[model samples]
Each structure stands twice: as structure tokens, then as C-alpha cells.
Target: MAESHIDLGVVTAPSGVLVLGMASWIDHWPQLGGTLSERARASASIGGGHVHDWMCEMVAVRAAGDRPLTVRAGTAKSPLDGGPTIATLEIDLGIPWVRTAGNEPIILGDLPVDRCGMVLGDALALDSWTGDGHPSTDGLADVTYWGAHAEAAHRQFGGELIPGRGNQVRGWLDLPLDDAKSLGDALGDWTGDEQGRGVMVAVDEHNDFHSFNRASRTHPLLIGAIEVADCPVLGINWDSGDHSMRHRGERPFGQVYPVTLQPDRTGRTTMRWTIPPYAPGHDGPE
Candidate 1:
């Protein structure tokens, strides 16, 4: 008797990989095995060349023979631009998993697998991520590594980034193009996944925050509103100086800053801050 393989389903995207949270439950799921796995081709807009494709396999050992297989694939329409492909698979496991794969100009979702790859080949082409130690196997540091590259790409192209609330309070903030780069740099390299990178870009870029909660991973703080003096306010927001979320004390609540771009010590661009006296624990001018 020959081994039987099921046509689980296929997901198509521009460039990013869509991992459907299989590793979490599949238990040592095959990086290249699985009855659900198969070969897939990406539909790029251009022609005159061979169509690129990738392996979409599910390890045979991990296949759940007792349960029925269900696969759903489709494109998530965006309010602004085209979105990435989303495919959900339910093969006995109760957990909900969706997969997507594609390149650039395609918006990524908040799935762990999606975040694992970050925006490596798409927006930011970092050689390091392509080499080895993928985030899925290497762990958190790898996630941060990919995140830094993705954030760098977003920095080059101005935008907003709103992450899922995930136990933290949520809100929104609008940033000016000029201020976006400076503030991103001053905040240091971003340290989240593709979802985090999505949250970092503003609405103008592609509104990647769609469906995901509008919040911050560290501490949820919104600027609410602000009024600056003679200096035109380039941007406004609750500057939570500490993104590490290490501070246990009552955070500097309502600490608003008038955003502006300025040259850092290295003569490179950075965000310059203008603190107000009324701000919590604000010590007057130096």
C-alpha cells in the first residue's frame, strides 16, 4: 500500500512566510515533513521568469489521522493598500492557526510564525536573518534581531505602529513624518516581531494595525492631548521614557513631550524633547 497525502490547503502572499502556530502543538513538527505539507508557488505580478515557489509541507508523523482536515485561505483586504494572504487550518488540534507567505508591499499579521520571519526579505533586506538561527528555533533574541531590521525598514519609510493590547491598556497616536524617524531612533532599535514592526509604522504607510489592538507592549500610555508654545508641535504623545517596563514605581503618568528632530552627538538625526513644567514630577528648566 502507498502512503496517502492530503491536500491540506495552500496560502499565497507577496513575500513573507505565514506560520499557522503549528509548532506550538504539532510537537516537534517537521521543518520539512508532514502529510499536510506540499509545494507552493507565489504569484508575483511580473512575468518573463520562472515563478518562485516554496515548500508547504506538513510532517507525516505529526498528522492527526483521527481528526478531519480543514483549510481556509484568502487575502485580507486593506483599507489603504493590499494585505498578506491568510490561511487557517484545523486538523484535530483545537487551537486556531492561520498561515501566510509572501514578499514585500504585502502587510503581515500578528501570528507568531509571521513575526518569526519579521520583515526580512520584504521591507528590510538584512543578510544576518537569512543566514541561520531563525527566530522560531533560536528564541527571543532572534525575534529582536529580525525586529530591529524590520524597524529599520520602517524608519526609512515613515509610518505608525500599533501593537495588540495583550493585557496592556490600548490607545493611538499620530506622528509627523519628520518626527517619526527621530523618535524611532531615540527609542533605540525596536524589539518586537513583525506585529511589533507593523505597530511601529503609522497609518499613512499602510495601516498595518488593522484588526490588531492599538496599544504598546511596555506600558499603555496615550498623550491624550497637548498644547505647545511658539515652537510648532511636530508631534505629540505620552513619552514613556522607559520601554523596558522595568520600573515598578507609579510611571511618570501623563508625561507629554513636544516632538522635534535634531542632530545627535554623532551629527546623525535624533528626536529632541521639550518637557513641560506641568508634566508629572516636572522640575522646571535647568
Candidate 2:
């Protein structure tokens, strides 16, 4: 009997032999069962592709699945800007359990199943999370990753990102047109996934915290209130009202660098930090 149709985003093409996450090229890619290829014609744009579409290339024929049906794929651009290369890939199906991601239809290739246990980041993503209404697999990263990519692409190519927040906390940071290269480089590693994953940054006057979470793109920090500085940085002790349960999302204890011409790498960067629900010290300082 034909398997129940699973919406693979756009159309329900028969559940292909593989399921993959679509993204720009990464220098470090995963390896597949069969030979990999670049320059795909109908490559699926599942996660995010606008950012690297020009700088990075595309791929297909990565039907490579593992005994456990694990797969990984990525691409990267060359200095010449000739095209992005499919790189940094690996898939080990040694896991005892083998099942599709919630039985939802995924790409034929592009699995995250790792034999030696999932990576720290992957483990966090794969873990079941329900602090709020967000499930671990509910595209939390997808929201963060593609959201930023789309914002960047729209600003660079189409124009300033839409759904603006008056002052534009999430739009293009007054970067020189030539700085597109630098911008892309700085944001290349940014991803949308923010599940069990967490990071702590020191807070300081010279720093300005920015929530890449597109949900808070219009956040007062990004939008800037009258009292707040133009670029918002997470301070050790910030205004409770400002930091209060933003959309019920967990706030990062660390701060991001200030939006200054020169980054103050001195004592004003990230200070102390921690990921919540997993308090560092049982009864340590709050």
C-alpha cells in the first residue's frame, strides 16, 4: 500500500528514498553512500538557500542513505566565486534505532543520524524540548537559520528586509556595499536552531546584544526604545521589564558585541553566561 502522503513543504512528491536539509555550502560536509554531485537543477530549498545561492553552489543525486538511513550534505564557495563545492559530509547508521523524523516526509538524502552519537549541536536539536510551546524538532533552528538568511538576502539583493520594525534592528547593519563579503563571512556560521543548544557571553558597556531570533527581530532591543541604546547588548543586570519573558522565549544570559565601527574586545564584551533549565551550579549565584 502507498505510504500516507507527507507534506514535504511545497508538494508531496512520493516519499523519496532520502530526506535532506537544504542550506548553503559548508566547507565541512557529510559523506554519502554514492558519489556526490554539484550544480543541481531542482535542488530542494528546504531550510535556507538565499544567502549562499550566489556565492555557494547546489547539489542533487545525494540519495546516499545509511543502514540507519543517516545522511549529511553541504556546499561552500571558492575564492574565485566560480561556484560552491559540496564538502564536509558524513553519515553513520550504527544507531540501534532507525525511524524517520516523526514519520514526517523528509528529503531522500541529508540525514543527521550519526553512528558515534549525535554531535553536541545535533544532540540538542534531536532532544525533546518543551520549555515553551516549541518542540525540539519544531524547526527552531530552521526559524533562526533561514530567517536570518532571508533577512540578509532581502536586504542585500531585494532591498531592506520586509516586516520592518520602524528603526530596523534586524535589517542590514549600515554596511558598505563592499562589505557584503564581510557580512556573509560574519554570518556564515549563524544558524536558526536554538533548542537545547546554548552559549554564554560576557556583558560589558561596549557590547550590544542582538537576538538573531527572527521572532524578536522587532524586539525593543533591536527596535531600540528611547532609554535603550541604539544597538542592544545583553548586560549582566538589565531592565527586568525589557528582559522579561520575551514572547515566552528563553533569553540568552550572554551578550553579543556592540554594533560599533570598532568592536570593543576589551572588558566590555560578554561577561558571565549560562543556558537556562540546566542551571550550572545547583544553588550558585543567580
Candidate 1, position 5, lDDT = 26
Please, what is the TM-score per model?
0.18, 0.18
Model 1 segments beyond 4 Å from truth?
A: 1-163, 167-174, 186-286
- Per residue, candidate 2 scores C-alpha lDDT tens digits across 20-82 of 211212211222221112222123233211111322222222221222222222333322232
- Predicted candidate 2, C-alpha RMSD: 23.0
- In terms of TM-score, the best-performing candidate is 1
Where does model 2 exceed 4 Å of error?
1-8, 11-17, 21-27, 30-168, 173-286
